[model samples]
Target: MAELISLDRFVDVLQAARREHIALIGGGGKTTLLHALGSQLGGSRVLTTTTVMGHDQHGDLPVVFPTTDGDVARAARNRAVIVWRRIEGKKAKGVAREDCDRWFDLVDHVVVEADGARQRPFKAPAPYEPVVPATATLLVSVIGADALGRVIADQCHRPLRVAALAGCTPYERLSATHAASVLLHHRGALRAKPAGARLVVVINKVDDTSRRSVDELVDVLHGRDRALQVIAISRR
Candidate 1:
């Protein structure tokens, strides 16, 4: 049943979450989830931004590099706004987390992609990775269900780190237990989650063939962290 946790539940979780700031971390599908949440939250004053992101991945929202509260208020008046500091080559640099904290009161919701995974389906974070905001009230950690059964060297964003966390060789085939090790590790996916924030683990890209492995993964996660909410979703 946990393997069947749907995207609809993911949306419902985000919709019910509060504190005006939601920060996304970990790997798989952060950007897509950010946009989807922003649209589904149905806020006219929703603000989407990233700690780091491709300059061209702004989705359809109007981009605003705000320097003042009035700047944000003016641009985010009655529409979704994408905020960034400046475009640095292929990447759009994000504002400081302090800026996000301040903008919390300026908008209905501020959704931030607080990590970068180089588009890999799965990842294990380095010490400085996952720049989650201190003010974030909700933290969403994403993992790819497809990473199971693949060679970590070929499938994970940071193979060495994943290997370190999972206690397997970099070239070893990944298993549900291997993925569980990272999810349960304090320095892994839960690295920077704020104490007051709600945490949800999202196991994404589920299909019929992946159900058993996904179920196994959920069982391991809950076995270790009874408070954790794990949501497994298939494609839209």
Candidate 2:
């Protein structure tokens, strides 16, 4: 059986540096992972915005919308800070990648949720999607293990794009092979990845039912690209 690790341990496994910018992409557990990392790192971490996220997702963390560099510098001094441009209805609009880059030196860790999945278990990127920061030092691509065995059209965000990437019809059942293909494809989950950044693939919501599928996906991914590090976890 594969080992299950806590999100904090998973952050440790990534060997994230204080000065690094980490971008979370794909679906399922991106926001959960961002919050976990923020909590784990404690003070000096900045949860900056990118893509579209829920307006009230920050929990008790102090928020600075339409934030300035000075605001980030101040909030990041003793605690984790959530930075954004403003709130638009139910969504919190994030600052630009360029804006995030400007504060790379001010915070200990800048965690960016760089994609939106409409709360789906998995997703395939559309062209001009996944707004990753150019200065990102690590990119984590996530997918839910629950996505396996489900109909692609029903379980995934951008079902047509996922089908196109996996070379299957939308109504087809998702297989380990299909899941692996989507994650490793150049224009799939790895899209908009920054140059020279380390890449990590996270398979979340692993359990007895999804364990075999997650293992198969990991095996296939490693077999195809040894450089890719795959981690499976139950992110609850």
Candidate 3:
């Protein structure tokens, strides 16, 4: 198996350039990836959030709830900033997809968390989920290597949807084939993916125990979608 690449190299692999909108879907370290990319890209990057996220998800980045275009222009001057609508209790609600387009005029890069997984390692998107912006140039589908050998119901969000796509019951163990099925499924993690956008799959928590699973999953993905890039990493 290949060694885990550095986060900077990971960003390079994604080909994330300035003035591009990147939407992160699926589960397993989406927030971590978002911030890591934000930190790496620096300069005029706006994390235009879309899904429900925790209040502290941005760490120390200045957060701006842009009620007007002037506020957005002001936040875009910073090296890195989080743009959202408001914080409800402990969760931060993201602005609508239409509103996300407005930030492009101010910032160079926009990173959007398009789905919610409730801290689970893997997930299948529900019908009305993953609010990905149509203008996204990159779509990253994330899953955890640790999900291997565990029951789908125990470690996956929307386990029933996963089971349906994987052709198994919730209590069944999550095999590499099953994982591949979920990722490759049109309406699964890749839902609402833009036509011309680059698609990358990130397999997180790739320890010794999960290496084989990651490899198998990658093999399956390549076989099905030759253009898709599969990367294995240990975000922890």
Candidate 4:
């Protein structure tokens, strides 16, 4: 199995934490964290299919629609999460508004993917994006070291905004300093995060030369505010 982060602290914090719903965001290791949590639970979870174009969950976990009928919802009571497909290929698929109304009552937990489809290291908003309710208990944002300055700008749907935020003329202006700033900026967005929901920062792709040591970044983040906790990993 892939090296797993000991989630005991997280489990303790969230088992009775305020928020009931949790959404994973950002880029690096989002799926890895999801699978790690799901696998740790070692039980059935309703893995809902999503519209985000990428690899599929190869497991046999039972999946049900957010629009599933009452009977279907009841049938999926044994599921761990309802993998809601919000956007398909950068377009909104369904918002899970009605789906949440019907099924949220049945499941013990609902793990939503708060995916921002821009595909760049720097986050950007999209049209008809899935706006998950603020009730999400956790928001996990992933950041890959490799994406810090390259693919995010080169392949992003929009590079201008990213460059502007990074205060660079171009995406190429991104550097370790830029990466640290972006991480901190995104982390700041969670300042008003609800008491129940936990915001986790996952620094991934440590295998990449650009993001090898997080000490500088960690020091910077904590230097600003020592309350934050960050976990670093490489899913290469």
Candidate 5:
């Protein structure tokens, strides 16, 4: 297991250039971490975009691409690409994987949203699988403590809800009890690690009135995945 470090170390890793493709999953703190990292690395080594999955475009980072492309060979050559994990319009899905494998060298960091709220965590859409490539060194998944008791929905500003079509009974919009459920379910689903993938978990919305305490949350998260580093932050 990795030794725990100060929040500063977490921020350092988040800003470090060691990793190429980082995926922010879960809830609350995802956008916060992305924006913070994007701003710190902007104009220097980082670039950002969205797949129309959520309203992440409004965040601090500049959006380089508005759509998702599995084969971002041309775009990846000189700049990092932020991919929207989910596709919209239902007309044409995102890019293909073969193209990404062929042109994976073009990008330095391909930030992809690993999971959406519409589906369970860690599960990808049809015919689509996680593609950080061997070149990518970082793979992050985010979760929110505040999402515990609440059922994720398409609120126009939030990212895609994993439970949107998960077939689980919808709970109230956002409740303290429900927030707990969200945290447990999300953490449970994300405990497994991908091969050769370094995983990190960000527990978001710690500032929620019902979730000011971090000890239990941290314990629950660490218990789930000892190697999975967990950070608590507020997205609201």
Candidate 6:
């Protein structure tokens, strides 16, 4: 069995990881999780940005939007952040990958959302997906337990890619084994992950899944990557 963990404990892991520039990939609640981490980092100067993200998600938070170095240092100095570039139509543009590295000196921690999942609860990246910063010291790969037992074509982004990675048919119902296979694969969850970054996996929305199913997914993940950190979460 995997260790019992909670959302609060995961915050501690992120808090201790400020070598600690964090990037989020995979599916589930990436934006929700990233912003929540920025909010709960015990009042640290955390700057939240993204490689690619949608515009409506920010929801009027006091973000350092358009993220200039002087503006970011001023706004994020003693507040939780939601920094981004201008919103062109539906997308909230963010800084270039190397720029996050440049701003790392201004904040205690930097977190970026590095992929788009089209609102699906789960996904597998395409060739050009997940634009993680090379400077990130920690990577959080998330999967929604609610996706288990759902039809791949209906419930996942890049269903064909997910099918290819997990060896399941595109129209088939997803399973714990399939989720684990894709989540553990280098080209799946770790797509574009930075070298030397510590990995933490969050099986989100466990409230919608059975205990047995969630455990099965965690066990398969651990059986393959013994050192992998797997935690089950109901929400952000």
If scored against the real structure, what TM-score would every candidate get? 0.91, 0.95, 0.94, 0.69, 0.55, 0.90
The digit string of per-residue lDDT tens for model 4 on 24-123 reads: 6655545555555554443233333223424344244444444445644565554464354444554334345345434445555545555654444445
- Residue 35 shift from truth in candidate 4, angstroms: 2.8
User: What clash count does candidate 2 reach?
Assistant: 0
Give the residue spans of candidate 5 off by over 4 A: 1-10, 13-17, 42-51, 54-94, 97-104, 118-136, 149-193
Query: Where does model 1 exceed 4 Å of error?
Result: 3-9, 44-50
Tens digit of per-residue lDDT, candidate 3, span 97-199: 8776667666778889999999999999999988988888888999988888899999999999999999999999999899999988888877788888888
Q: Any runs in candidate 4 off by more than 4 Å, and if so which?
A: 1-19, 42-55, 66-73, 81-98, 101-103, 118-122, 126-130, 149-152, 155-157, 186-196, 208-213
Q: Give the least accurate 10-residue stretch of model 5, judged by summed lDDT.
A: 120-129
In terms of lDDT, the best-performing candidate is 2
- Candidate 2 vs candidate 4: the TM-score winner is 2
How well is each residue in 16-103 modelled by candidate 5, as lDDT tens digits?
5644555555534444465555444422233332222454443533333334443444444443444333445541133333333333
RMSD of 1: 2.0
* Deviation (Å) of 81 in candidate 1: 1.3
Evaluated against the true structure, the overall lDDT of model 3 is 0.84
lDDT of each: 0.80, 0.84, 0.84, 0.49, 0.43, 0.77
Candidate 5 is scored at a TM of 0.55
Indicate whether candidate 4 or candidate 5 has the larger lDDT: 4
lDDT of 6 by residue, 1-236 (tens): 54545666668754454447888888888887877677766444545555557777774567566536777767777666677777788877887777788667777778788877887889998888788888888888888777888899999999999999999898998898999888878789777777888888888877634567888888888888888888787543
Q: Which rank order by TM-score, best down to worst?
A: 2, 3, 1, 6, 4, 5
